[model samples]
Target: MALNETHDEYEQQDLKRNLSNRHLQLIAIGGAIGTGLFMGSGKTISLAGPSIVFIYMIIGCALFLVMRALGELLLSNLQYKSFIDFATDLIGPWAGYFVGWTYWLCWITVGIADLAAINNYLMFFNDGIAFTPVEGAMISIAAILFIMGLNLVTVKLFGEMEFWFAMIKIIAIVVLIAVGIWMVVTGFTNESGAVASFSNIWSHNGMFPQGWGGFLAGFQIAIFAFVGVELVGTTAAETKDPKINLPKAVNSIPIRIIIFYVLALLIVMSVTPWDQINPKVSPFVNLFSQAGIAAAAIIMNLVVLSSVMSSMNSGVFSTSRMLFGLAKEHQAPQALGKLSKASVPANGLYLSSVALLAGAALQYFVPDTVRAFTLATTLSTILFICVWVMIMISYMRYRKLRPELHEQSTFKLPGGVFTCWLVILFFIGTIYIMSLETDTFEALKVSPIWFIILIIGYFGFYKPRLKAVVDSKI
Candidate 1:
């Protein structure tokens, strides 16, 4: 069955359900673990010291609540292609329109940011064989084409590629953990006379080494790490046996966080004192290099490279699917609703690629746009939190008006409406935390411009057109 196909479509125009349990599981894992763990963990550890472990757990738990709400909403009605669908049916058409376009832009900006990161990661191999600016741009273009090619082929190819990309990340972390355990148990000492041991976690100035200020500072970076955790919610339409697969994916989030995030960080700190970790360097790379692994830099660079590529791949798939959903609701241009023979949203993919192409051009021509790109990513993070809040809002409406549905739901969100409020408050608090940082604060000031644009577009454009569509049916 296709994602949004109805008997009215004659089975010719719908997203085919080619994704299996395997795809969903790995997609969930890939969404939960991002390149941030590899590239940004050092800064987080340096900021909060050993207490960073608790920070990840706290953020993980909050997002798991958000996922649980999303899972229950998705399973309640299989016709709900994504949260956008339910947001329309339960909240209002306005909610759907806002979330659909906002989510689409979220992925677009994140995709652009990923492209920039890819270019930098490629430059890491700039040894004797230096990559000229032209060569670097070519590499970035090739990467974009490669990911876009996978998306244009089949959804399964995207899933398979993500499975392997995620597998590499998992393997890298597992290897790091295993090696760290060996070093700790054997009391391996480094050149700095620091011995590897579990005691290293708190032995240095204790777990809350930097106190509450530093602990709060960690949230500013750590929240972005979990940006894509709700990504599995987007695949509900194409998932085979979503009831089994979706819950399994959502339920495993806590365990994945403990293993991939909490445990992985614990191992990194155990092997090296938190204070000694370099904020500018990757802890994963540093850990391997410390363990006497000569190819550690090469190996970790490849892993991070693949990690960014995986994100771009997922971004392409997500943005395209979002356009498809929007078109089905008549909120977007009809052309975007068209599907390829492979059941992929070709036009949506093309449009997203064009946006990314613009991003590449910016990188090549402007060259001093890191601040602009950072602002874009920060705004993306703010929009993601908005989407999550909308999901929770939709869930609350579902319980209020569709009480019978809630009664019949087997996989109910624990604490129900109360949990919804708690998650919403947590996100509001996160936005406040963002304001405390100079860089993120700038993004916050700029974010309202996006909503202002959305408001004008909705009233000035989409609403009247939607009204006409409804009037024509009468």
Candidate 2:
């Protein structure tokens, strides 16, 4: 399709480019920093030891390439609203259908996990007030509604909320890094008698303390931390200047990985040996509490709460947009494509919110909420891998079919098609790593059922209607 032709077609639709450069930047930042890093890192460290650092770095590098490919595609065709759009145009409508709904399901699961996380965080300040899982589920529903309300207001309001949310996360990481450095430089000792020192990283049974199996286990959870990084690509339709702001957001992935993941992990391990880091509590809170700073631990908890909220907020926004995009392409009900007078996809937003709320109710059914949440998270990560792999495949196809566009594009992905293939291999390896663990392997076993359902729905429902519409148009 011609660029102008596609542009004109979407111009008739109502979604506006209201998100500013600052919003785009912060959204990208928020996507990179997830609560998994705060809450899940401890488990990863215990499993992989200090080698978790390399796992994060390796995943970050591979995902950066995924973002680069996504960025190149979005910029290459301004008419394309998001990756889902280009996937359909470049690949096939089946590609769009599968990716769009899978992404929506991905965020729904993430939102469910975040709601459970937020409830657990709130109990920290409950002050002996007993809160049951049902009550937590109620609060989770309320929080989802509140975020949905914000999204219904205006895109600008959504952006503003994200900006502040991202800001809090940034400040929290910076504070943690600074305090960790101080403890290391001053040789501060923890209650456990683990003296602060950079040598702590390697001194405690070497870097790969748990051997290759443990290192492989780290990839399962570490990949979840990077789930939202591709969120920036979803905002392509609403971003002010895709060429400038989008590239800036995509290119900054490395710097974020270095500061947020690598340096943060290095300092945490330095202050407290990897072996001593509690697998249950957050390393951030643990480090401060071990140093006799109760106030800082409270602050870190609050920061973690904010991070979880930010992630859920982004989840709601992206999933709703995916539904809206699906509706526009006739992959979903026409009702979902309708935008309110405020230029928001109010229907799609509500639909996604309802799905998320249903997920919240899982707390009441599952006997062990933590285990259920872990399974949900693993399932979401697997679906995300599918989405990222689709993007890579789409980019490869874009290059082969439209080499002229690739040649003319100002921002070309380095390593081109070769890098795309490498990233695919990296994701496959991560999935293989996930399969080695029992919990994650269970999630992998259950995940394919979702795709099977999607396949059945496509042929049973969508294919006949789509064919009829095409025949009429022709």
> 464, model 1: CA deviation in Å?
2.2
Q: For model 1, what is the alpha-carbon lDDT of residue 276?
A: 89
After superposition, candidate 2 runs with Cα above 4 Å error = 1-11, 127-130
111-223: candidate 1 lDDT, tens digit per residue: 76676666656655765243555665676678778888899998888889989988998998898889889999999987688999999999999999999878887886677
- Candidate 1, residue 48: Cα displacement in angstroms equals 1.6
TM-score of 2: 0.96
- Candidate 2 lDDT at 78 equals 94
lDDT of 2 by residue, 1-474 (tens): 542344345448757899999999999999999978987898899999999999999999999999989998999989898767999999999999999999999999999878767776676688625367688778878888888988899888889999999999999999999999999999999988889999999998899999998998988888899999999998888888889999999999999999999999999999999999988677988888888997998899899998998998899899889988987777887778777888888898999899987766876665254566678789999999999999999999999899999998987899998999899998898888888899999999999899999999899988986786676566
- State the displacement of the C-alpha of residue 327, model 1, in Å, after optimal TM-score superposition: 0.9
- The residue-level lDDT of candidate 1 at 308 comes to 80
Query: At residue 69, what lDDT does model 1 achieve?
Result: 95
